[model samples]
Target: MIEEPPTTTQRSAEVERRRAGELARPLTRPAGPIAVYDTVTDGMTGWQFLRTGRWLAYTAAAILFAIICLFLANWQFDRGQQASADNAVVAANFSAEPVPIELALPTLGSYDASQNWQRVSVTGVYLANEELVVRNRSNSGTNGFEVVTPLQLSDGSVFLVDRGWVQPSPTDALNPDSIPRPTSGTVSVVVQLRPSEAPLGTGSTTGNQIQSITLPRIQQTTGGDLYTGAYGLLNSQAPAAEAGLTNTQTSMPVEDVGTHISYMVQWLFFALLGFFALGLAARKVHRELNSDDPEERERASARMRKRARKPFTDEELEDEEIDGFLPLTRWGLSSGTGTGSVAGKTVGPTAAPRVVSPAAPRMALKQDDDAGDREQGD
Candidate 1:
C-alpha cells in the first residue's frame, strides 16, 4: 500500500480553514501604563465612565464630610467669640468705679458683676471674742491663714469678715499660756472676696477635714443674710494680746478664662483637619477613576450570554447545522476525507451515518419508463 501526501489544494484548504478559525476569535488590545494614565485627561470615555461614577460617589461623600467639618469649625468660632465677650465683661466691670460700702451692700444685686470680682466693701464692726484664724491661706505669693471674724455692724446685721493674711502655723504648741485674740469695737477692715464654696484646684481631701473660713458656707451653717458679699482684713496677725484674737488672711481674684480657650482651639483644629483630608481623598479618587477596569461590564455580558445559551465558537455552530446528516461540503462542515469518526465518535461529515442502503438503490429512470409504457398501452 502507498501512502498519498496532501495535494496543493488540500494543503491550501487546511491553511484557509485554520486562518478562518483564527479570524473568528475576538481581538483584544492589552493595556499599557501610558494608555491607562491617558484616560485621566480624556474626561470620560469607555471604562472612564465607570471611574466617573465612582468619582461621583466619592465627591458626594467628600462634600458631606466638608459640610460637617465646616459646621464644627463655625461652632468653634462661635465659642471663641463667646469667650472673648466674657473676658471683655470681666475687664470692664473691674475697671468701673468702686461702689461705696453702704450703697454697694444694698445694690449688690443691682450689679451682678460683684460675683466675678473679689474686693467690694461692706460696713460692719469687728467681733472681739470670735475671730477665727483659718490655715493654708495663700495670696499673691504669701501663704497664711485666713482670719475670719463675725462682724456686728452698726445696724445690727452680722457679716462674716475675712481679714487678709496672717502668719503661717505657729511653731510652739506643747505648753501654751495664752493664744492671740482681737479686741475691737468698731474698726474699718479690708478683705478679698471669695466664693463660700470654692473648688480646691488640687490636693487630696481628708474625710471630715475641716476647711477654713468660707463665707457662703459659713452663712449656710450659721444661718445669716446672703446679701453681704465682701470680706475685710484685720490689722494684726495674732489674736489681740489684750483680747487674744488673731487676724485672718484671704486672697481671691476672678478673672480667668480657665481652659475654655484651649478647648476652642482643639475643636477648630479637628474641623480643619477633617475638611482638608476629605478634599485630598476626593481629589485622589477623581484622578484614579479615569484608569481602566471594565471587568464588571465584561462579566455582565458573559452572564447575559450564558442565559441565552449562544455559541461562542464558530465550529460549534457549524456542527449544529450538520446534525441532520447534510453533506459536510454543502454546509461548510469539513468532509472527513482527511479525518474519520472512530467507533461512535463523529469526526467530520465524510463518514456521516445513514440508514439507506446504496447497493440496492432503486433506478428513477426505470420507474418513469414503466409508468409511461403502461399509460400508452391503455
Candidate 2:
C-alpha cells in the first residue's frame, strides 16, 4: 500500500490559510473571553482547561475581572447620569443670554449639585504675561501645550482659563515663544464648567514651570486646586475661533452612562472571584487537611522529634585497669625468688582476692577433695 507524503503544518493549505487569516485580522472583542478556541472543542475543551491548576486561577481571576468589567459598566452609567444632569443645567444656564461677569461669582457659595454646569461670567484683569502652558499635552495625535491664562477678576479672585491646545513648534513640543503670547489686559470672561483636581501620589518627573496648568507630576510639584472636571469637552462651539487663534477643537469624550454601574459590577465581580479562587485551592487540599487516617504522618513526626531530643550513652567506651607497681620481672627479682612468695615470706603488702578465671573449677575440686579427706579422717 502506498501512503501520501506527510507535510509540514505551514505547507498545508488549510493551516496556512487559517494562520494568514489570523495575521490579517484586527483584534476585536468576541462574544465571550473563553470562546477563543471554539474550533478545538469536542465537548472536552472546558475539562482540558480545568486540568491545570492555572484553570482554577484563571477562573478566580476571571470572576475578579468580570466584577471589574461590570463595575466599570455601572460606573460609566452613573457618569452618564451625572453628565446628563449637568447637561440639562448647562443648557438652562447657557441658553440665557450671557450674564454680565460679576453675577456668576457671588452665586457660587449658594450653588447646588444640580447646578454643576452653571455658567460663570467675570470682568477680569487678565494676567496674560503669566501665560502658564501645561507641557507634553497631546491632543488628536499631535503634541502641544494646554495654554492656561490666569484671569485675575475685578474682585481680585484668580481663575485659570484653559484656552486650548496649541502646537508650539511644527514638529517639536517645545516652542514657548511660538505659542501665541496673551496680551495682558482686562477682558470679559465666560466659563460654563469649573473643575477640581486630585492629589498626585508620589510622582517624580521634570515638569513645566508654568504656574496654573495642571498635570499629574505638575500637581505634585505645585500642589494647587485645579479643575473639578475637564471642560469644553463638548467642542460644540468655539470661543477661540470667536476670539480668532485658528485651530481645530479637541474632540469631546464619549458621554457614556454605563461607567459607574459598570465599575460597581466589576468590584462585586472581583469579590466573588476572590471567593471562588480561594474555594478551588481549598478544594484541592481539603481531603489532606481533614483526613482521619493520620497515624502514619503523626508517627513520622513523633519519631523525628524523639531523634532530635535523644541523649548520649556510655556503652561505647572501654574500662581501663592501672597496674599499681612493676611485676616481679620488672623488679629484677630472680625467677626462683619470685615463686608465689617474696623473701621466703608473704609479700610486703596484702594482695586483693584473686578472680581466678584459669583455675576456678580446679580450686573448687580441691575444696571438695579436702572435705572428703576430712570426712574420711573422721
Candidate 3:
C-alpha cells in the first residue's frame, strides 16, 4: 500500500509543530560584542559575572549617567531654594507700613537685600534739569526708558528716584518721545526701595540717557553725596506731578515654587530607573543562560529573540511578492492560495500571499547543530 502525499493542512501543522519545538529548545551562546549569557554555564558564578569586564563597563556607564542626572537635580534644587527666599523677602516688605527713608537707610548709600520692596517716605526737591532716562527699560512688554530724577533732601544729600517709564520716540528708537517732567520744586514721595542696577558699560550715554540706574555713573554729572546702594520705584508723590508716566515697578514676586521641584524629583527617578533597567536586563541574561530547567531557558531565549526580531517592512513584503513566494499570513499559513483546506475546513483567500524568510529556521538549525557538537565534545 502507498501513502498519498500529505495535504497542505498536514504540512502546515507539521511546520507549526517544528517551529514550536525550535522555540522551546535551549539557546546556545550568541556571538556578538553585546551578547548576554548565563554565568553558571560559562563556568562563572553570579559574583564572577559582576566582576566581568563587560558588566563592569556597563556599571561604569550607568554611574556616569546617574552622576549627570544628580548634578542637574542639585542645580534645580538650589534654584528652588533661591526662589523661595526671594518670595519670603517680597512677602515681608511689599505691603508693610511706610518707614522714613532715613530709618531704612541710616547712612548714605546704605541698603540691604532684606529692604527690597520696602515702602519709604522721603521729602526732597525735584531737580528736573539733572534728570536722566535709563535706557532699555520695558513697561508692559513695550520697549521704553525709565525717567530717573534726583531728589535733594534736607541735609544736602541726593536720592535717585525712578519716576516711571516713557516710550521711545516713534522716529528715533534710542530716545524717549517726551519725558514727563517730575513735580517741580520740593515734594514728599512715597516709594518702594530697590537695589541700584550695575553699569552696563555699553550703549551711548551722550545725552541725559544712561544704560542703568547706577549711582556712581549718575554722580559724575550730579556732583553730590549720592545714595549709591539703592533707589526707589515711585509709589506716590505729595502734590503729585502735573503729568505722570506709566509706573515701572515690577509686579510682586510669585510665591509659587515652580516646576523645579518636580523636575528635581523626575531626575532622581530617572537615576534609579537606569539602575533598575540594568538589573532587569542582567536578570534576564542569567535566566536565559544559567537556568537548569530547559523549558525555562527556552522561554527566556524565546522572549529575547522576539524582542530582537524586527517587524517586516512594506518594501520587504513587496520584494517577496515580486519573487513569486507565498507570503505567510497572521495565521502562519499561505495567503491567497485559493480554496485551501484548513484544519478539515475549506477556507477562502482573504489576503495576498506573504513570504516567510528561510533565514530564521536556518539559523535555528545551525545553533542546534553547534550545541550538539559542543555537548559531544564535552
Candidate 4:
C-alpha cells in the first residue's frame, strides 16, 4: 500500500522546527585573539587590520584627536573673553582725567595694565645724549622710529620718555634726519602713561637704535634708575622747536570675538567628524571579522583587502563566483530522479529518484531570446 503524504499541519510544524533551529545558531562568528606581526619585517596582513588591537588603536587615536580639538576650542574661547575685557577697559579710560606722573609710575617694581593710558605730567631735564630710538614703530601708515629720551628728575631718578615718532632717514634706518629734542633744562611735559614693553629677542644695537623698550634693556645700555614704564608724549615743552617729528596716535586694541568663536566651532566640528569616521571604520572591520554568513563575510574581507591595498592570499583566490542560492534538493513525495515531477502524487515502490548534479559557476540569468521574440511578434 502507498503511504499518505504529510498533512498540512505536520508540514507547518516541521517548517517551524527548522526555523527555530536556524534561529538558535549564532548570527556571527566569534573574533579570536589578536595576532601580532612586525609591520616592517613581515608587512601588514589582512588579519592584522581586522584584529582587536587595530580597533583599539583606532579608538585611541580618535579620542586623542577629539581631546586636542576640545583643548583648542577652550583656549580660543578664553582668548576671546580676554580680548573683550581689554577692549572694555580701553573704552572706559581713554578720555579719563589725567593723573600725576608720580602716581602712574611704579616706585620700584612693575606697573599693571590699570596705569595704561593715564595722562600724567613730569618735570625733568632731557638727557639728549642718552636718547634711544625704538625701531619698527609706525605712525599713519608711514615707517618710522620712536625717539625714547631719558628724563632726569630733580630727586636723581631717570625715566624713559617715548617723546614721539620720527620718519627714518632715506639713507639709513638707524640715522634719522632729526628727532624732536625735548626742551633743554628741567621742563614739565604732559604725557600718557603706558605699561612697560616686554623685552624681545636680542639684536645688534648701534648708537641709539633699539628693538623694544623694557626697563632691563634700557638699564643695560644706560645705567640709571629709570621708571618701570614709559610715557607716550601727549604734549611736550621744549627749549626750541624741533623738525621732522610726528605725534603718535595711540589707538585702543580691537575687540574681535567673532573670529575666535568661529575657530572654536570649527575645532569642535573636526572632533565630531573624526569620531564618526572612526566609528564607521570599526563597524566595517567588525563586519569583516564576525559576519556569520559566508558570502557576506567574504565580501567584507575583499573590501578590506582592497582598502588596505593588499593582494589576496593563495588560499583565498577563487576563479568562480559564489552562488547566492542553493539548488532545491528534493520534495517529500518521491526521490524524483531524472528530472521527474511528482505533482500531488503519493510516494510508493514505483516512485522515481531524482539525481542533482553539483552546482555550477553562477551566471547572470536572462530570459529566453525565442520567448522574447515571440512576445514581441504577438
Give the best candidate by TM-score: 3
For all predictions, the C-alpha RMSD in Å is 24.0, 33.3, 10.1, 15.6
Candidate 1 residues 1-378, lDDT tens each? 545755656544543443222212222322211233434445554434434656667556766765775676566667677766656755554445544446645632232444344344555556656555554665557564555667776766666665444454356321222334544555544433333445343544332222554555555655655334544344332232354333343222233344555665665666567667766865444434433445533343334334323322455445433442122222222222322222223233232222111111123223333665799789
**Candidate 4: residue 217 lDDT (0-100):** 66
Worst 10 residues of 2 by lDDT: 316-325
- Per lDDT, the best of the predicted structures is 3
Summing lDDT over every window of 10 consecutive residues in candidate 4, give the lowest-scoring window.
357-366
Candidate 4 to truth, TM: 0.58
- The predicted structure with the larger lDDT, 2 or 3, is 3
Give me the runs in candidate 4 sitting further than 4 Å from their true place. 1-51, 140-142, 233-243, 283-378
Query: How much lDDT does each candidate structure score?
Result: 0.44, 0.43, 0.70, 0.59
**What's the TM-score of each model vs. the native?**
0.44, 0.38, 0.69, 0.58
What are the per-residue Cα lDDT tens digits for candidate 3 across 201-275?
675576888888877767776788999888999988889776748887657767567788988999999999889
What lDDT does model 2 reach? 0.43
Instruction: Point out the higher-scoring one by lDDT: 2 or 4.
Output: 4
lDDT of 4 by residue, 1-378 (tens): 555755657544544332122112222323222223445324433445535565677778999999999999999999889877777776766677666666776584556676656677777898888888888787888777888888888888887777788887888866665666666876777777677679765878677788887777677657667675564555545444365566675565567889998999999999999989987875555454444445654454344334323333333223212431122122222122211112332222222121111222112111122444588789
* TM-score-superior candidate, 1 or 2: 1
Q: Name the lDDT of candidate 1.
A: 0.44
Error of 1 at 201 (Å): 10
